[model samples]
Structures are given as C-alpha cells and as structure tokens.
Target chain A: MRLIGKEEIENIAIGAALLGTGGGGDPYIGKLMAIQAVEENGPIRLLSLDEVPDDALIVPSAMMGAPTVMVEKIPSGHEALAAFKSLKDFLGQEIYATMPIEAGGVNSLLPLALAAQIGLPVIDADGMGRAFPELQMVTFYLEGASATPMVLSDEKGNSLLLNTIDSVWAERIARSVTVEMGGSVMNAIYPMEGHFVKKASIKNILTLEEEIGRTVREAMKQNINPIEDVLELVGGTALFEGKVTDINRRTEGGFAKGTATIDGLNKNKGSDCRLHFQNEHLLCEVDGKVRCVTPDLIAVVDSETGMPITTEGLRYGARCTVIGIPCDEKWRTEKGIATAGPRYFGYDTDFTPIEQLNAKAGITK
Target chain B: MRLIGKEEIENIAIGAALLGTGGGGDPYIGKLMAIQAVEENGPIRLLSLDEVPDDALIVPSAMMGAPTVMVEKIPSGHEALAAFKSLKDFLGQEIYATMPIEAGGVNSLLPLALAAQIGLPVIDADGMGRAFPELQMVTFYLEGASATPMVLSDEKGNSLLLNTIDSVWAERIARSVTVEMGGSVMNAIYPMEGHFVKKASIKNILTLEEEIGRTVREAMKQNINPIEDVLELVGGTALFEGKVTDINRRTEGGFAKGTATIDGLNKNKGSDCRLHFQNEHLLCEVDGKVRCVTPDLIAVVDSETGMPITTEGLRYGARCTVIGIPCDEKWRTEKGIATAGPRYFGYDTDFTPIEQLNAKAGITK
Candidate 1:
C-alpha cells in the first residue's frame, strides 16, 4: 500500500461510507478530520501489514466511547496522537506504524489522522472487516490478543494508562475514564508486532475501505449512481431503496439498540423493511424475509447525495437506500455467522447469506 | 481466601445463579462441572491477590462465546484445562492459581473447576463483578493485561495458539475458532503476575459469588424467598415483580440481544415493565420511568422459584422478579456511565438508580 492523495481520501471516505452500511457514524466529520490531518501534516504512508518489518511495534489508533457522544463532543484532535506518544514514552521504544482497527466512519479515518500527524503509515488492514460496537468485540480479543497497555486520552488532555488483567477490564476501566472525560476519547491500543498482525488481521482492509470509499466518490463525481458504483467495487448487490417510515428505538443494553421500520419506496414500496441496529445495523429484514445480516455491511445512504447516515442518525423521515454488501470471505464461514450473523445478535434464525436472501427475494437484479 | 469446601461450592452456584439475574446461563451445569472436578481432584485452595507471591503466575480462566451456545454445547470438560495447560506450557511456568474473569453463570464457576482439577488455588477476586459478553470487556484488559498468546482448544483436541496484535483480534480470532468448534469454548487468558492481579481484580468475588449464591440456596431451603436473600447479600433492592407478557428477540450482533416485556403482578399489577437485555439486562423500565440501568446489575429472577433465567430463556407467561444491585464504585463515575448507561446503550434519558425508581413507584415496601 502507498500514500493516498487528497482526492483519494475523499473518495475513500465516500467508499468507506457506503461500506459503513449506515452505521459507522457520519462520514463528513471523519472526512474533515482526515483531510485536516493530511493538510496539516502531509500525506501519511499507508503500509500493507505484510510490508512492515517483524520487529516493528505497531499500535492501532482510533476513538472509543459512544458514537452518539462523538457527534456531540468533537474530538480535540490531540487525543489519538497524545495516546500514541504517551505509550511510546511509557514503553521506551520508537513506534513503527499505525492502522485502523476497523474501517468504519470516524475510526476508519481516525488512524489516517493519527498516522499523518505522527509521521507513521496507516496499515492496509483492520482487525475486523467491518464495524462493531465494543472494543473487545474485535477478532483480536477472541484470539487472545491484548487491548491493554492501552491508553485512553480524553479531550481534556487527561490520559489514563490501563494494564488490566483482561479485555473486559479495559472496557470497564476505559468506559469510566471516557465518561468522566465526556463520553468520547481517543485510544492507542492492540500494540503488537507484524507477526501477530499477519496471523490475525483481516489483510488489506484499509485498502479495501479505500477502494470502496473511493469508488463511491468517483461514481458520484462522474454523475454515476453510488449504489451501482459500490457494487462494481466489491461485487456487492443493492438490496433495497426505501424511505424511513417508522423507527422504534430504545437505548437498551448499554447500546443504541432498536428496530427501524422502513417503507419500501422507489421500487421497494408495497413492502416493508426492518433494520435492527445496535450502534450499527445488524440485521435488515425485508418483506418478511431476512435480507442482510451482520458481519456483512448494511449501509444506508442518501439516495441522491450518496452521503451515509449512521444508525444513531436514523430518523423517521430520512430518505435512504439500504445496500447489502458481502463482507470478506472470512465473515461468511460458520465462524462468521457465529460472530456476525443475525443469530449472533440474538435472533433465532439460520445463518443466511445476503446472496441467498437476495435470490430468494428477487432483489438481486 | 482458601479453598471453599464442596458445600460452599454448591451454595455459591445457587447464589451466583440468583445474582446472574436471569441471563448468565445455567449454573447447574457449571456447578456440576465444578463439583465433578472437585470430586475428581479433591479440592482447590483459594487465594486472595494479597496472598499470591510476587513471582506467582496467575491466569484468569472463563468460557468465551455466547451463553446461549454454551447452554446448548456442553463443554467436554477439558477445554479450560487444555487452555490453562497450554498457557502454562507457553511461558514454561507453573500457574500458581486460577481466577474467574467475571462472576456470573458458567464462567464464574469455571475457574473453580479448573483449579480443583489442577489442584491450583482459586482466586477470590475477578475482573468484573458481573458477566459481560465480550472477552476484552474486562478491567484487566484496560490495565495493560494481555489476552494474547491465548490457546483456544476445541473438542476435537484441535488447539490453536493465537498471538494477535490486539485484544480485538483476540475476540475476532477466538470467536471464529469458537464458531468452528461450535459457538462455545473455554479460554484461559490474561496470564499475569500476582502484583497485577492485586491492582486489577475485584478481590473475593468467588467468595462474594458463593455467599450470594449460598444465600439464595439457604433461603430457599428454609422456604425464604431468594430475592429477599439476595437483597441481604448485596444491599440490593427489589425493583419489580411480574410475569413476562412478551419477548422480542433478534440475534444480529453475535449476541442474543432483545427485550422482555413483563406484566406487573403480585405486589403490583395493571402496569407494564420492559427489561432490555443484551447478554445482560441493560435497562429496566417500569411503567414509564427508568427503574434500573446498565453498569448497575438489572437482573431478573423467577418469582416463585427465584431461579434466574437468561434473557434468551425468557418467555411470555413466565413469572419474574426484577432486582437492581449496585456495581463496582468505579462504574458509578461519569466515565462508567458513558461506558454502561441507558444513554451509553442509546437511550436519551438520564440514569435513575433502582432504589430511587422503586421509591418513586412506591415499590419500596
């Protein structure tokens, strides 16, 4: 992977927005943050995880805490860099590079900012292929990776270093510090060598995110349909386009988890679709059939502007198009379903692929 | 803390089940597993973090994956032992003792089983006072603990040692392996020094769980209500009593997340209660006010049996009593709220403690 230019960042944001599947949070802020970082610090090196030397100490950087809070509490832009720098001092070692743990919304663009400012390259991969709510929900923790020696930096410039005995503790302690700091904080964690990254990371995800994000931008700039452009980039299928009719959401389970009922419009009318989101859309049900389930992206985009809206941003009157995109093959196996399927989210349903569901619904056209 | 007797182990399961508040899964199986291990290997010594020698190697052990799956897939009884032994061998050190990562359901008693089986002492403390879904959601993970170099073993005796770059990968890679191994696996992680445990652990949790679990058992044996017994054990408050009238569940985020609507009965009726759960009860709304919220334990128990049923186990027509207990003081901070409040979960309302809500609703009696 190489450095992406200014135009490419905008394209990547657009593509990442579509891939965000309507839950990575507002991309505009992330785009602005990334663009600012690039402008101020110069182009960041986007390194492939494979290209990094084995001895290179890599740290994943991003924001943590409630995304809803992120919208309200704009980052100070110093938290991520501060966290990374503090860890370097604490560990008494020069840092090698950085990467996004997941390529979604602010997090996707966050590392770009951090790496640009710190003069390191963002890796072309992430721990998770898509977005998730919790820090420990990443593939790394399940494989027994560390979230620790983690530093959470609040906007107030207060930094807390945690060396918990487990990942849950990291979340537990970080949550308190984050809330105390105002519900949003920047974090530098999952510090590991290239060997571990190669063993566990979903390779080239940053590149994939960049490709997907870029495709959306280029398509729109050229007067092309974003959904169609996105499909070509990832071989994704446009599942449905609808108007948000009703959203019955309740902040439950320490997450913004609820169901949004959408009126099928513009070819999806006469049919109803339901989106189940917990900070992100986990399940998209259409016409009484399971359409798109998690681990796969379920981004909701503005039908015209092609901008993305997060699950938190979902409203009753929002006109949107629901797109179902296939995740990497790693997310399709039985293990994928176990980690990202509808059942994994609590629905007692069989693991059905988006491709199969589209075929069943005749929506694959 | 020393080894709890076989009698205490039995009692602890009962109390732990009650404290589980209807979502930690069957302690029956965990108890049986612990009992069998204790019977087979005699007894385990219990140790306080303070008692652990500075050089002693301590590894926290628990089941990592879905509780719903754990109920379905009976562990082959050797997974934890395998993970522990693997980890023990990896560092080439004798593990001085074992500890529970969290104190709920099967995971609570898991380390007890391992400790007794290996003749290692059980630590009285745990990472979290209650159960959470993710592996990296622990206080230890926040405090620079490593979940990596973890060994995940399947029943087929296929073991993979993972050294991910971060905690998220641990969750990711382990969840994938678990999905392949059948959605449930035992993991021994966060191998740390005794000094780390002292700083990170909520000490005497097994003792706490046992006392709590035992209180429920003894009260029931004496024909006393388990809820009342629980209240006494932890200075808890009874939030509500009712019969489940509806359950809306969907598994979308690799977690069995949903809501259970309970009809107020017994002491109160003609009112509605909604308890939202994602692995654990995140919110408890009685009538229209928020009665109990996350970070604080909002558990449900059977009205008659007092046995706690998991969120997935809830069904219409089942009678339940809602209990609200305080969480660790650290969770009471603003940061804690950001990590685990109704707002954290996506609700717009502020948190109101169960006691205050109970007082408001005249349920204080």
Candidate 2:
C-alpha cells in the first residue's frame, strides 16, 4: 500500500478524464473533490489488488445518474459515508477497503475521496479499466458477479438498499431511483470478497491512470504533444484530429445522451467525425465509417495540452485529438462484448477491434 | 383477540371496497388471496390496537401501484413474505403483527393474507380508515409517523429497503420504483410500536369494514337495496343515483387517474354527476357544482345489490349509486386536509364536510 496525496489526485483525474472518454463525469470536479478531501483528512492509502487478503471485503463506491445533474448537485461528502455505513450494517461485515467501479472521469477518483474521509484503503483495481454508462457493463458482471445487494444514498439523507436477481435489474431499478433522488446519488455497490474481486477485476487501473496523467503533465511542461506517449503507453491509436463543430445533447432516462460532430483538422483534413455518447463515448465514426465502438476507449484531448476533455466540457470550436485505446482483454470476450458492444447501444454493427478499424483506414503512425 | 377465516375475509373485502372509494385495488382479487392463505394456513389472528403490548412492533403490508396494473399482474404471494422478512431483519426485532396502511380494497385484505401466511396477528387498525393514492395520505403521516424503514418486494425475487427523510419522500421514491418493478410491488411499511399504532392509526377500521360488508350482504339476501343500510352503518349520504355515461381513465405516474361521468336517474334524472380520482375518488360534482370531495369518501356501488365497485370495476353502462361518507375525525384537521384535501388532488375548492355538502343538496336521508 502507498499514500495518495493531492498530487496523485490531480494526476489521476487527468487520466480518469481520458479513460472516461466523453462521459463518466467531469474530471475537474472530481479533482476538486478529491483534493479537498485529501487536504482535510490527509493522504489516502491505496492497496494493490494482490495485497488484499482473500477474506477481505471490498465495496466499490460510485455516483449513479446523469452526469449533467451531477455537476450541479454535488455530493455533500457525507453521502458516501452514509452509503458505506448502511451497506456495511446491512452485510454485517466490516468492509476492508473501497474502490471505484470504473476508472473514468469522476468515478475513478470518488473512491479516493471517500477513502480519505472514512480512513480506509482504496484497492487499486476497478471493474472497468475505463468507463461504461450502465451498472452491468463491467468485467465483474461478465464474470457473473451480482451488482447487489447495493445501497444508494442521496445528499438528502434518503437511502435505498436494493437486492436484485441480476445486475441488469439492479441497473434498471437503481437508475429510476437515482432519477427520483434528484438525478444523482452515491452508491455502495458490487460488494465482493477479495478473492472474487482479484479474479474478476481489471488490475493496476489506477496505477496506469497515474502514469498517463504524469506523461501528459510532463509533456506539457516540455512543450511537447503527449498524444504519442499516451498512445504508446495504452496501446491506443490516434483516430482523428479535429475541431468541434456541433453538439446535440439532452438529458433523458437518467442519461446525458447526444451526438457531437468534430470537423477534421491537420492530417485528417476534409473528413468529419461523429461521436455518440450516453454518459460515456459509445461510438465514433470518421467520414461516416465506424472507427471505434464501445468496450473500446474513445477519448478527446486538447491538441496543445493533451489534457483530457469530458463530454460535459466539450464545446464547439475546440481543437482536439481523438484517440481510441484497446479495451482490456476481458472485454474482448463474447459475453463482455455482448453486454456493452455497439449493438447494445442500438448501433447496427458487430464488435470490431479499434486497431483493425485503424489499419483498414491506412493511416497508422 | 379473534380469528379471521374465509367468512371474515369475504365481509371485509366488501367493506374494504366501499371504503376504498373507487381506487385501492380490486376487492375480488383481495378476497381470493386472503381466502387461499386462510385455506393453506388456517385462520389469521385479529388483534385490536388495545391488545398489542406497548413496545411490540407493527408493520403494515400493502400493494402500491396503479390499480389497473395490479389486476393483470397478480402477486405470487411470496412477495409479501419477502417484504416482511426483510423489514423484520432490518429492524432486528420480531414483528408483533401486520396491519393495513389503508382499510380500502386490496390493501385492507393484503395484511390479513400476509398475517395468515406468516402466522402473525392482523391488527384491527389502519393508517387510513379509507384509501388514498399516495403513501403519506394517511392518519399515521398526519401524526408524523414515518412510512419507512420500508421494504418493497417484487415477485421476481427483487427487493428494496428504503429509509427516507420523510413519508412524502418515501411516497415519491417508492412510487417511481413501483413503476419500474412492473408497475406493482408488495410493501411492508410504516413500522410502528404498539403504543404509536394506537396513537396514530384509525382504530377498529377492519371491524368497521366487516360490519359494512355484513350490512351489504344481508341486504342482498333480503332482496332489498342495501344503500340506505350501508349509509346508516357508515354515517354516509347517498350522493347521486345514476347510470355510467362516460369514463376517462389513464394510468400515469403509478396512479390510475381519471374522471367518470354519470347520467342521473330516478329522482336525479335531470342532473349529471362527475367524479374525479387519482387511485381514490378525490372530487365529486353534480352539474358543475361541487358535492363530496376528499378527504371525504365517495364510493360507487351497484344500485340493486349495493355492492361496492372499484375504479377498475366501473363499467360504461353500469347502473350505480354514488355515496359519500364522512371521513374519520383524524382526517378533518388542518394537517389532514392539507395532506389529502380537494386542492391537494388538484381540485379547485376548499374542503367541505360531507354532512354540510349533503344537507345543502337536500339529501338529509
């Protein structure tokens, strides 16, 4: 285990925003929340997955609802504690650590903030190496992990403990309840024993996020573009270089769903790219041809700073570089693909590797 | 204490339907569920509020959703047991008895069925002496009794335990969850100590329901119209006698909300009556002038047999008599009226007691 102070939180937030693709939540807000928490309560302890004993209990914490609403209805710090306390009481077992369900945007750093305040270690593994919108879109779910007994606690002191037959049901019921609880609520979900978590989780996600964040920060200091380093680190492909032209977004069914258009720039001139998202980037198309789809990471970064931009922060006329990182090996499996593939998001396409799509376009760097 | 067998269920169903005031749930379905439970587990014990020890725990069981949905999606009986067990476990104490949140339609009989199956006593008291759509529209709520720690269980082995800041929040959140859980779910709610039950609940509500049922059944047996006898028993007035002409109904936001129009007959042939409801009848008018409005009770019964008709049972051509009963004294106070008054249900009038409305209409009988 090692300590994670404000610096670590800042670096993690940048990487989280990139992995978050176009959704999850705003990394800046996540950074502020984590920094304040660390400042108030001291550095947090982050344990590697291997360090957790088999008998230890780990409950991942998250915020569930539309990312749009999350910005305005900031969690009151106490909501996470309330959720953890209620879940721990319900399980009648002491929780050994907390972690993020996804290593993306705001969710990746939320557990760190919570750990600092609650004085618990945050496990370094996450269910999703990046992020997906729904609760069931996780490697743990693909491995047959149940998303409940789960607890959702709002800032209003209202909480609900849900026990569902399957993870999908957990998603449906919890989504509606989250909407009712005013768009966003904190969750203590997917309580698992360390043995099962070690088997099911994508390991070293936080460490990778920190590396990516540090790479971007150092590159910016040296007046260099960090996209090349980021691509090499994550085995990612630069899909498009573009200037944002238009965005159409609406908050619907507890999700911020929309399509964003980016006009091509630099080497990708004369081509236009369309990115579709529901909380996270789900599908990306360049010149009307699919380049990357869900279960694959699609991130947009500032062309100059290489700083990741959240979908909430994506405005028109921004010069950016869009990249596609290959997802974890676990997500390439049939079950994983079926759970969060392009088809699952209502796109009429089968799962295809981002590298394969990149090669077909014949512009590999 | 006494035993409640099939006969008692039959009588209570009738009276429960009457008090249900055109909402609650279908009486026939409630009777069948209770009868089956009694046949399998013998008679259920009936305990008056006075019989419960001061510190004994009481949990009321009911079904929440649009009445229209409850008809098609019959519960599998296990839902209530699951709800009760969950709530009992959460409280970590043996529940002394189960009661009804409302003494109306299916809600009134659901507790009896659950009592038989769980072998717990059924308290002869209820939060609402009659039915109202929302959870907080009860005497218990007026007395500041919380509607949670509550458990909502569905037939699909899903359950949610809720703890809200207030009863209104409970109603808002639970109602949305009910809609998501296939539009209906069983609930164990408003847990109270015996002393609090005695203070907050409407006493002898089940007994009153039974007496009204007996009156209607005996009147049918004697081949006489039971409306007068029923009126006398509940201190109600015959509001209008008519044949159903027009009914507009829609299930929205987990409630069966609509209006029904009746063409006058006999002494009231020249006039028309209108009834408005959101789960229960909340407003009644004759030719545009307001008559009986909630928290007063308005029920429709078959003119010939004097058998109560649920909102679900209201047919386009059914000959029916509309009756208005004075609500329990608890519902007449400022808090009570504010909780379920005419304006609360979107009617544009102040609450006028049924007696005053009836006297103004020259229907002293």
Candidate 3:
C-alpha cells in the first residue's frame, strides 16, 4: 500500500491528463480539490489490488457531464462524498474502499478526494487505464460488470440512485440526470466485490500515471527532451512534432468534437498531421494515412513545458509533440475492440494496434 | 371504501380528459390498461381520504413526458408496477394504498391499475384536481409536501430513485431523465403518510370526474344539450361556442405549447376567442379581453358530443364549446396562486376567478 499526499496529487494530475488523450476534463480544479482534501484529512491510503481482501466492497466513482461546464460551475466539494454516502446508505453494506473509474484527467483524482473526506482508502487500480467518453467504456463493463445501483449527486444536495438493466442503459439514464442536474454531477458506480475488481480492472494504472508524470517532470528539470523521455518510458512512438496550424471545435450530442491540424517542424518539416477527437482524441492521420486510432493513447504535450493539452484547450500556434502508446492488453481483446474500436467511432478502418502501425511506418521503438 | 369495476373506467376517462384542460395525454390507452388490470386482478378498491388509516403509507404515481410520443411507443404495461416495486423496496415499509398524482387524462387511471395489480386500495384523492405541465404544480407541492424519495421506471426495467431538496428540483431532474428514456416514463412520487395525503391532496377529484362524465354521457343519451349540462354540473360557465379557424402548435422544453383561434358561431357569431396553452390551457381571451387564466379550468369539448378535445387532438375546423370553471378553493390561496396561477405560466394578467370573469362578461352560471 502507498499513501497519496499533496506532492503525489500534482504528479497524478499531470499523468492523468496525458493518459486522458485530450478528454477526461480539466485536471486543474480536480488537483486543487484533491490537495485541499488531503491537507484537511491527512494523507489518503492507496491500496494495491492484491492487498484488497476478497470480501471488500469497492465502488468506483467520477464526475459526469461537459468538462467545459465543470470549469465554470465548480463543484461544492461535497458532491462526490454525498454520492458515496447515498450509495453506502442504499447498499446497506460497509464500503471497504473507493476506486477511480478511469485514470484520466479529473476523474483520476476524484476518488482520492472522496476517500480523504470519507475516511476510506482508495484502491490503486482503475476501471480504465485511459479515458474513454462514455461511462460503459470502462474495462469493468467490458468484462460484464454492471454499472447499476449507481448513485448520482449534484451540488444542490440532490441525489439519485439508478438501477439499470445493463451498463449501456446506465450510461443513457445517468447522462440524462447529469444534464438535468445543471450539466454536471458526481457519480459512484460499479459497486463490486474485491475479487471482481481484481479480475475486471486495469491494474496498477495509478502507478503507471505517477511514473509517466515523473519521467516528463525530471526530463524537463534536466533540460532534456521531455517528449522523447515520455515516449521511451511508455514504450510509445512519436507520431508528430509540430505547431498547431488550425483547430475547429463544436459541442455535438453533449460532447466536444473537433479536429486539429499540426504542421511539422525541425527534422520532420513540411509534413502535417490531423487529429480528430470527440471528448478524447479518437484518431490521428499523418499526411493522408491513418497512423493511430482509439483504444490507443494519442497524447498531445507542450514541446517546452511537457504539460498535456486537452482537447478543450487546443488552440492555434501551440507547439506540441504527439505520441501514440499501446493500450492495456485487455482492451485488445475481441470484446474490447467491439466496444471501442475504430468502427465504433464511425471510422471505416479496422483497429490497427498503435505499435504495429508505428513499426509499419518504419518508426523504431 | 368503494370498489371500481371495469365498467367505471370509461366514465373516469371522460371526466379525467375534461379536467386535463387539453393536456395530460390521451386517456384511451390508460382506460384500456385499467380495465384489463381490473379483469385480471378483480375489482380495485377505492378508499375515501377519511377512511384511510393515519399511519398508512400512500404513494402517488403518474406518467411523464410528451403525450405525443406515448401514442407511438406504447408501454410494455409493466412500467408503473416496476416504479412502485422499486419504491417499495427502497422504502422497506408496508405501503397501504396508491393515489393518482393528478386527476387528468392518462394519470387518473394509472393508480387504479397499480392498486389492482398490487392488491391495494387506491385513494379517491389526487395531487392535482386538474392537470398542469410540471410535476411541482400539484397541490401536494403547493401544500409543502416533498416529492422526493421518488422512483422513475421505464419499460426496459430501468429504475431510478430520486432524493431531491424539494418538489421543483425533483420535477426538473426527472423531466430530463424522462426525455432521455425515450421521451416518457412512469414515476411514483410523494410517498407520504395517510394524514399528510388527506391534508395536502385535492379531495374526491376522482368522484368529481365520474360525476361529470356520467352527466355528459347521460345528457347525450337523453338528446339534451350535453355542454350546458356539463357547465351546470361543474358550476362552470360557457365561455364560447365556435369553430376552430386556426391552430398553431409546437413542442418546447418538453411541453406542448400552442394557440387556437376560434370563430364564434350561432348567437356568438361576428366575435372570436383565442386560447393559449402550454400542455394545458393557461389563458383565454374573447375579443382581446382576458376571460380566464390558469388555476381556473379552460376546457374545450366537442360541440355535439360534449367529449373533451385534448390539446393533442385540437385541429382546425373542429366545432367546439369552451367552458371556464372555478379552480379548487385551495388554489386561490397566496401560495397556490404562486404555484400554478397566471403569473406562474408567464401571463401578464393577475388570476381572475372564473366566476368573476363570467359575471363581467354577462354570462350567467
């Protein structure tokens, strides 16, 4: 087991944003809230999946709604804890610990804050090693765990407990409630036994985030190429190094969807890449050919600061480097591909693993 | 206590539609469902408010969303029961009776069917004596009863339990979920003790509906003027007798809003009346003078048959007779006026009781 303090929250925010692949909402407020929670309640204990008892009851949680709205609305800082308490009351069972629904952006830190406030430990693993747009896109859902008996709470002290037939329906109903609760809400879902959490979760995602975050921070401190260090540490390949030339964005069906064009520079001058995103970066195509797609991480980081740039923050003239990392092996299964592959995103091509795509393009790992 | 047989459903439907004031959806399917439930589970018992035990648990329920969508997507006939069951499980108490959230159109019969299926008696009182667009418009809400600990259920077996700060928030949040759950859902709300139900509810609204329906049907059989009989029975006044010359309608924010222009006929020829509505008729003007406003009933019925014409059924060229009836005494109070009067519906004029309006227009009741 490990303990998460003020310093650890900063690293987790940076790492989570990178893994968010441009979605997962802004991590700044989440980081601040988490830091405050830790400061007020001392350090939060983080338990490894293996350390959890078989009978332990764990519930994963996060914020649901438009990230843009979240920045302005700002949570009451008690919505997450309220959702946890309501769920605990409904379940009539002693909740052993809290877990992150996804290891991306703001959601990565929500559970830590909730744990600190409620005097509970947070499990180190997560439902998604990286962020995906919908609630049902988590690995737990892919492995047949239901997201029902879920609790959604808002800043106004309003809460709802949902019992849905399946994970997809859970997403549909909860989303409607989220929109109604002023366009955002905190949710505690996927209540399960420790055995199920161990089997269905993407293991050690918090540790992965810390490592990725530390690698970039150290590289920047030493005045080395932070992008290259990030790529090497994650076994990812550099897709592009360029200045953003154009960006087009709009909200459609409750999601931020847009495209960004980057003109390559330095060693790869004259070439350009296009990134298409819906909440998260879904695909990357260089020149004309598709280089990477969803289920693989497509992270955009500042060339100088090494800070991850979310889709909501994309703007013209930002010099950045894009990297493609392979997803967890569990997401490469047939079910995973069916759940979040290129076709699921309305793309015509089949999902080609990020590493395979890089190797085919003659980019050495 | 009284027992309602299958034969009584038709009268109830007719009366409920009249009280709907051109909203509350169609009562045909609801009538059929109620009759079927009665046949399947024996006659449903109807308990008067005074007969209810003080400690008995009472739950009021109804269908919410676009009435237009309900015609296309017929329920699986189990959604209401599902909502009741879920609420029952959550409360973990012995529910003694069911009640209608409103005595208008489809909702009037929902509680009867639920009572028959669950072997519980249905109270003759309802939250609303007449239908209004929002859930919080009910008399229970105006009287300070909370609509929380409510359950919303869809035909697909998805259920949500809401615990909100107040009745208005419950409506706001539940309406969003209803829209998301394919534009309609069944909800069981306002779980209260029998004593509270007696104090907060619009008493004997169901019996009033039955009386009005029977009077109209008997007048039609006897070849008497049914509209005049309806006016006399409800102590209402004949506001206008005309043919619909123009009708404009659209759905906004989940409620059907529209206006109808009527050209006066017979002795009233050479004049015109305009009826404005949002779900239910909220205002009426004759020769550009305000004749009636919400909190008072504005019902339009087929001229020859005395059958209420719902907002959904209003079309150009339909010959109709409009009537204005006084609202329940409770609705004329300060708090009641604030809840569902002209101002609440965004009308510029203050609420004028139907009797005063009729007297000023020289229309004797």
Question: For every model shown, what is its TM-score relative to the native structure?
Answer: 0.51, 0.96, 0.97
Which CAPRI level is candidate 3? Answer: high
The 10-residue segment with the lowest total lDDT in model 3 chain B: B264-273
TM-score (chain A only) of candidate 1:
0.90
What ordering of candidates by TM-score runs from best to worst?
3, 2, 1
lDDT of 1 by residue, A223-294 (tens): 776666666766766666778988888877567778888887765433788888887888888787788888
Where does candidate 1 stray beyond 4 Å? Answer: A89-92, A266-270, A333-336, A362-365, B1-365
Ranking by DockQ: 2, 3, 1
lDDT of 2 by residue, A217-291 (tens): 999889998889998988888788889999999977656789989998875533799988887888899888899
Ranking 2 against 3 by TM-score, winner: 3
Candidate 2, residues B109-171: lDDT per residue as tens digits? 888888888889999989888888889998888988899999999999999999999999999
- The local lDDT score (0 to 100) that residue A297 gets in candidate 2 is 91
lDDT of 3 by residue, A95-164 (tens): 9998898867789988888889889999989987888988889899888899988999999899999999
Q: For each predicted model, how many residue pairs clash, with residues at least 3 apart or on different chains?
A: 91, 1, 0
Fraction of true contacts retained by every candidate, in order, equals 0.00, 0.92, 0.98
Ranking by lDDT: 2, 3, 1
Which pairs clash in model 2?
A: A23-A279
Model 1 chain B lowest lDDT segment of ten: B156-165
